[model samples]
Target: MSAFEHSSYPEVAKLTIPDVSVAALDMGCLPPVLKRFVEDGAMRMQAPVDFIVVAALCSVGAAIGTSIRVQPKAMDTRYQIVPTLWGAIIGDPSSMKSPSISFALNPIQSLEGEMRIGHKNAELEYKANKKIFDMKLKQVEA
Candidate 1:
């Protein structure tokens, strides 16, 4: 029971996500969760939902239902959710415009990934800074 751990301390803030491996995706193997299904002889996302919080939770839920094990790096939760919502909307190519299927998507630029989704760190900063597009104005004697 340390003084710092207590919520009463003004400096102490609650962690949005605990240090746990969530949203781990295995791109190598066949997707066991979502399998093709015959909806009026049309193949569609049947089992493992990806966009989230709709008919099937995993595909659309905020919580990490499926194991998305990839690189150990910080990623933008907001940016990541965009693709999920898009996938759900387009997963079934021939389906009617199911407006009830509520999902959100907005543009996101990969600034870097540690500080604010995509702002290059020191190592990457050095590489990016290497290409400065500034032109120096030479001083001429008047």
Candidate 2:
């Protein structure tokens, strides 16, 4: 007998999942400059404001690095927290998440490029200086 024609198996009921409700993002919570940037990015890229906001905040945190620290308690210095932030943007495939992240991190990427160039130049200079110093040392020993 064909699988479809078999009547011995019991019918299974379909499962229904309820929709989840999420609170809307409040623009007032963000700084004026950041609010403006997020708004502009959302409008221009046709992306969600939440995505831009999260991306911007993450980028800012990465840029800050571990340079600044905050003591949560006034009296106690034992608990120190770095201002670093990590976040993830979860959405459907065509929700513009990638574009939002790229736009938000543009400034950081530019800075990184500049830093890379500077580092390369410094490395070259160090190598040249080391070569000169080695030559001088050899002459001094002879």
Q: Tell me, by TM-score, which candidate is best.
A: 2
TM-score per candidate, chains pooled: 0.19, 0.81
For candidate 1, write residues 41-82 as lDDT tens digits. Answer: 122333223332233333333334334433333664443322
Error of 2 at 2 (Å): 18
lDDT of 2 at 77: 93
Report how far residue 46 has shifted in candidate 1, in Å. 13
Q: Cα lDDT of all candidates, in order?
A: 0.35, 0.95
- Evaluate residue 44 in candidate 2 and report its C-alpha lDDT on the 0 to 100 scale: 100
* CA lDDT, candidate 2, residue 91: 92
In the predicted model 2, the residue pairs found to clash are none
Q: Could you tell me the lDDT of residue 28 within candidate 1?
A: 33
